[model samples]
Target chain A: MNKLLKNSLRFVLFLLVQTLILNQIEIGFGIQLMIYPLFIMLLSFDTGVLSLLAISFTLGICIDAFSNTFGLHTSSLLVFSFLRPVIFKLFDSREGYDLLLEPTVLNMGNGWFIKSFGSLLLIHHFWFYLLEMFKLNDMGYVLQKTVYSLPLSFFLCVLLQYLFVNKQYTK
Target chain B: MRNFIAFIKHFRNVLIFALLQGIALSLYFTFVQFPRTQYLTTAASIQGSILEARNGITKHFNLSKNNVRLQKENIELLEELPKSFIKLEGKLVKIDDTLHRQQYEYIPGIIINSTHSKRENYFTLNIGSSQGIKRGMGVFSTNGIVGVIHNTSEHYAVIKTCLTKKLNTSIMLEKTGQQGFLEWDGVNARKGSMTGVSNDLKIKKWAKVVTRGGGGIFPRGLPVGKISRVEVVEGESLWDLTMIFAEDFRKVQNVYIIKNLLLDEQRDIEKQTDYEDQE
Candidate 1:
């Protein structure tokens, strides 16, 4: 399969699986597995910032449609896409600018990838939940939701990246 | 001109990204209109069905407790029946005894799905259109008002619960008759705030609150909750009051759908007023 076609197919599959399957699994106590961000994180490093933003927007809107909230997911996804490049720069290795390489635990090393992915996942979850409770008067509630959702989303994203990215196993 | 052309050529991707983002935002705004859109609601229906099925299993243990509560409510209603009869004595007595029908009826239903986690939460009932359930009807548990019917399918109906931020129930102080709008702040399921109350009204703690019937959705004098706390916002002429809901929505099993016969006429009058305003 062509590289672009393959990536597009993966993006659609991830979105469908996330919306139709993963979102349904609420293990009680506010822990929901958020795997939608994996699509944006798996794109090749050389992918243009514009394309990344567009893809993120599309993914977010699709999820938002299913969730029945207007602009909340789209705005959060836009923020995540906007910050992805900065996150990459912060965790960049000494041997930078590898055009052939994508974001994978094998290529980027598990330690750096986990840290970067965790930060981005936190950002996405925070914005998403905050936008969701837009009219809430209590900041404490917002903080609580963000704190509870971040780790769950981070773990899910990392696990998905490791499992499907065909990367070398790293402890 | 050359620099401008070169810039456009070099950063075309950024422009495309911005365009796509704009399109996405527009689409979000367009399709994500709340309380509407079949696509989103269909998903909610599916989720509601699954949750309802799960709740049905878990709630089996609570059946005995629910029965006890229902019995208590039945006793209370029987006690109130004489008072209602006394109140309606002059108006209803003059009518032919056999010709007059019951003014109001309550149909018992079970909440199959409920959510307190989201800002705009909705629940599903086991009774629906087939059971004479329709959109715009009111729902209440034995304790107090629960919510209003949002949409209805064949055997199920979606109810936007009182806990939802999008819900606003017209309410008043039972003692003072001061009207206000009750809305949930999307944080607590057990509590919400009553806005639009004038500062002049002496809103004491634990004052009885009930539906004002101003909205035409709920009948007059349905129990809402008691005023837990009252605060006069600084520099504002309105008092913000918190209410501890009378009904425990978390354990809500059976609910009564309040079908008001006068709803269509009221709605038509309101629509005419809106039309006049537009003109």
Candidate 2:
């Protein structure tokens, strides 16, 4: 498959899975499972930050439209995309990222993936809950929401890669 | 020129981020109250149709429960028929029913999509302006008040349900008539809080709360919920009244959109007060 076509397919698939399936699940304690940031993560490492931001904005708006969140998703997802290169650079491998490798756990190893993606997810979740709640008095609630949702969202994103991404990427 | 080019290069990413964030945040703030476009909402044709198709299959899962509720409501309505009771024509006074002009009309609709866990939740209905449904109308189920219609398009509408920060519809305690505004605390969908009920009043446990009809978006006596917990707000004259909604929004699949026939007249009359105050 053409790389562009493949990524485009992934975009649509992620949008549908997020809007249709995951958005409806309402386990309490503000644990909203956000997996679309994983899409921003999985884009080719060489992709320009401008293209990444654009893609994140587009994806976020689509999910927002379906979910009636207006632009909350768009704003948070933009933050995720904007901070991606910064976080990835911080966790840059000894030999730098292999241009052949995708940013999946299989290619990056669990240590690198956890360190980089975990920080990014924390930033993403914190920003998302803060904006959604937007009350200074409810700072504790915002932190509670962020702390609860981060692990679930992280687990799902990793699960998605193992289920969808090919094992041959390990070689 | 080279230095200026480098400046643009360095700050361009930040500028772009700022621009996108600005657009997103503005959209969030504006559309939550008054939606100007149908594009991003499910009120749009393509998204409405897609959700409808999905609802067709999933709606059956709650078939028996919904049927029971509907059947019970039908029985209650059926008992009001003249055939159900002997006409007390000798004692009952006959008045011209036409004297009471209908002020509200209900347009039945099914929720095509909804979310309950967000800080604000909106439900997309399968009916819209085509069915005489418009913005600012009240939506309710047989069980309880659902929401106010937030936006509408040709064939679909969105309801800004009780599970939102901005849905401050007025409600009152049934027993004492103590009035307050409904607000969601954003943690639990089943529970919400009302502000402005005074602390001095002894509000009974499980006393019914119903719409106060201050805005006329809802009728005066529509069921909202029951008072589950009442706490005195510290250093205030008000009670932090907790309520459990009669309607479980998670399973709300069907609803009715209210059309106030006299809304325009009411608005026109209310505008005169502003004019009088200005004078």
Candidate 3:
């Protein structure tokens, strides 16, 4: 399959699965499955930053429309999209990573993938809750939601990367 | 000038990102309508369709609670009817039979659709014009008043619940007769505030408050709730009072439509007063 077509297909599938299936699975006590960020994580290193930011905003708006929360998701998603390149630079190998291969365990190795994905996940979750509880009155609730949701989403993201991405990159 | 241009080019994506975000945020804060307002016109149609599919699932889960509530309401009606009948019989002996029949009538109803999670909440009941429910009639559960009828169709009527910030009722402390306007503060579903009460009125914790009959909508002396807290503002003359509602709106399954016997006559008299003032 053509690289652009394959990535685009993944994007649509991730949106559908996240909105329809994962959103419904509110694993007890307000901890929700936010697998939508997987789409940004799976993008190739060569993907233009502008296009990534646009796609992130679009995805966030689409989720916001369905969830009845208008702009909370969009702002959070844009912040993460803009920060992605900086996060990637910190974890980039001196030998220079393959541009064609996306950030998956199969391509990036488990240790490097975990560090990169964890940082991005924390940034995304923190901004998401901060924007949701916009008022200073809800600072406690914002912290609680961010702390609770981040680790669980990170674990799920890692589990998914391990299962789908090939095992050869574990070294 | 060239350095500034280079700086702009370097951060052009950030600028566009900020601009788009600003637009989205402004639209969200300003253009977006209140949940109930949008639900009444455009979104209600979509929600109605979605709810239709989920109705069976909710119905099955709500059956036990619904049956218990219905059974309790049945018992309360059975207990109240005999006393009401006796009162009616005594009045009939003095008044003409034609006039006696018009004084008392009960309309039974079921809540078909309801929502309580918004700033302005509303419910649609299954009894309407055909069932003698007219617009402007008051709806009450066995516990106390729920809401007033807003719009009515042939078989259904929409009720704007007291929980709505737009709804205000005249209520007074049963002990001191300190009257005030009661309104929901757009927060807790089970609690509301009563303003305009004189600060001098000794409003103790759990003091009883009821409808003052100042408004023709609710009959005087209907039980509202007990005062939970009272706070007097530093400079204001009235007390800020919160009441713990006697009726749990979340569990309401059955309600009665209050058909005021003298509504038309009362309205006519008010209209005449206005006309005379105009002269």
Candidate 4:
């Protein structure tokens, strides 16, 4: 499949799945499972920060519109995209990155993927809940939501990648 | 100019990040207080239709439960019909009287999309301006009050459900007639708080609470909830009260939008009073 076509299809799939399916499943305790950030993570390594910000903004706005959240998702996703390059640099391997390779767990290996994606997801979820509450009094609840949601969202995003992404042939 | 250009190039990504973040945050803060437009909300045509299509499939999941609830309401209405009562004395009663006139109209709608978990939750209804839905109209299910219409498009409307902060619907205790305003603590959907009622009034546990209809948005005597907990404010005369909502918002599918026929007249009269007081 052509790269652009495949990525576009993934974009739509992530949007619908996040809004239509995951948004509906409210398990209480402020545990909202967000997997859309995975789409941001899976982009090609060579993608520019400008395109990343634009893509995240678009994706966030679509999700916010569907969920009646106005711009909460957009703001959080923008922060996620803005910090993506910084986090990538912090966790960059000794030999540097392969520019052609997409940032998938299958391509990036388990340890490197976990280190980078885990921090990014943490920052995204924490910023989201904090901004959603926007009160110092409810700081405990914000942290609680972040703690409960991070692992579940992490697991779900990992599961989605494993189910969908094709392994590169070694032969 | 070249130095300035170099400066811009040095922090291009940061500048773009700040620009987008500013737009997003401003949109969030402004819309949280008042919905200025339906374009970014679920009441928009495209979002509404998409939600409606999703509801078309998911509504069947609760089909049996909702049908039973509808049937129960039908039986209640059936029991109130003139035919259900026996005429013992054959007394003539006037069918039409000048003493009372119709003042409220209800438009039925199905909820296409809703969220119970957000700090400021809003539900999108399947009806809109084309069906006579206007902003600030009251909405309620058969069991209890749902919310007020927050925004509307041509074909859809968004409801500001009671689960959000600052709902502030005027309500009174059924037993004592002590009035207060409704509030949600953003913790539990089934539970909400009421403010302004005095600590001196003895409120019974499980006492019914109903709308006072002071705002003309909802009619008086509509069931709001039952008192579940009450505590004294440490330094104030007001009672800190909590109640279990009559309507379980999670399972609520059907609702009615109330259009008060005399709202304009009431507003006009109130405006006159305010003008006189100012003078």
Q: Which candidate is the best by DockQ?
A: 4
lDDT by residue for model 1 (B1-279), tens: 999999998978667656765765565455424445434442355644654666668679689989999999888888876555556445554445787655456788887655556666666677777789877788998889999887776677778788776466789999999998879877667888888888986778999999999777788999999999989888999998999999877778889998777777788999999999999
In the range B1-279, model 3's lDDT, one tens digit per residue, is: 999999999999889789768855764554233232333311234433443344435456668877887788778778876445556445555434564455335588866556553344566666668778876787888788888886665566667778766566788888888888778754467898888888875778999888876557778787888899989877978788899877777777678888878887888999999999999
Candidate 3 on A1-171: residue-level lDDT in tens?
Answer: 587797778777776666445654434333556877878888887787888888888887766544444566677778788888889998878987677667776677779877887788788877776654456776776676678778888788778877766543323
DockQ (CA atoms), all models = 0.30, 0.82, 0.19, 0.87
Q: Best by lDDT, which number?
A: 4
lDDT of 2 by residue, B1-279 (tens): 999999989999988999999999999989887888989988888888988888898899899999999999999999997668877676886577986889888888999899888899899999989889878899999989999988899999888999998586999987788899999888888998888888877888899999998797998899999999978899998888899998999888878888788888989999999999999
Please list the residue runs of candidate 1 whose C-alpha ends up more than 4 Å from where it truly belongs after superposition.
A1-35, A39-62, A97-107, A133-148, A155-171, B1-36, B42-113, B124-134, B151-157, B268-279
RMSD of 1: 5.9
Binned by DockQ into CAPRI classes (incorrect, acceptable, medium, high), candidate 2 is high
Report the candidate with higher lDDT, 1 versus 4.
4
TM-score to true structure, per model: 0.73, 0.96, 0.60, 0.98
Name the better of 1 and 2 by lDDT: 2
Candidate 3 residue spans exceeding 4 A from truth: A1-35, A104-115, A156-171, B1-9, B31-59, B74-202, B206-279
By descending lDDT, how would the candidates be arranged? 4, 2, 1, 3
- lDDT (0 to 1) per candidate: 0.75, 0.89, 0.70, 0.93
In model 2, where do residues sit more than 4 Å from their true spots? Answer: A168-171, B88-96
- CAPRI verdict (incorrect, acceptable, medium, high) for model 4: high
Put down candidate 4 lDDT per residue, B42-91, tens digits, no spaces: 99999999999999999999999999999999999999998888887787
Clashing pairs in 3: none
- lDDT (Cα, 0-100) at A142 in candidate 3: 61
